[model samples]
Target: MKVTSAIIAAMCLVSLNLGYGAFYVLWSIADQAAVARSEAGGGFDPSQLLPYGNVMWVLAQLLLLAILVLDVVAIVLAIATWAGRRNVGRAAPSMPTAAPGR
Candidate 1:
């Protein structure tokens, strides 16, 4: 069924989003801690010399949160779509819509 394939695809997308979000959050916290430890242990402030790491860390944190939110949104969308929810996508409604230009 077309709807079934779309649902499966959506599920796969959600899995990847959540998995990557978890990895991102864990990595950001761990990396931040590691950087702090290394710095406190006498590692020079290379960030002052090369700002990429600092920028990357910040970006990673924001990205992690964004991904988490996006995953939640995707789950909500998937569930609503599967249940024949109305207005989920008026433009191109799911199976219940029949078709466009009708």
Candidate 2:
């Protein structure tokens, strides 16, 4: 792939990671707060009402795994692009130019 394309791809990957990370942090905080408030109430334990919080946490972990995989792929692609550029720069000319007159 062209160097320009690779740069663009890297930028996009970084943007996506930042967006997902921000949202994940916000959601995690909100979820934790809700759990705390529920536990503090005098009524029955809130966990019993939402036993699936653990499941949700597991799902969130899977989302994190996906983001990590994407980051690794992006880094590898960027490195490959740099390697390709270096190889191209170092390669010797394959053919000599012909004379203007025979």
Clashes by residue pair, model 2: none
Q: Over the stretch 29-55, how does candidate 1's per-residue lDDT look in tens digits?
A: 766776676587556665533346678
Best by TM-score: 2
Clashing pairs in 1: none
Q: What is the lDDT of residue 59 in candidate 2?
A: 80
Error of 2 at 10 (Å): 2.1
Q: After superposition, how far is residue 37 of candidate 2 from its true place, in Å?
A: 1.0
Candidate 2: Cα lDDT at 85: 72
TM-score, each model? Answer: 0.45, 0.68
Give the poorly placed runs of model 1, Cα more than 4 Å off. Answer: 1-4, 11-15, 18-51, 85-102
What local lDDT does model 1 show for residue 41?
50
Predictions in order: lDDT: 0.71, 0.77
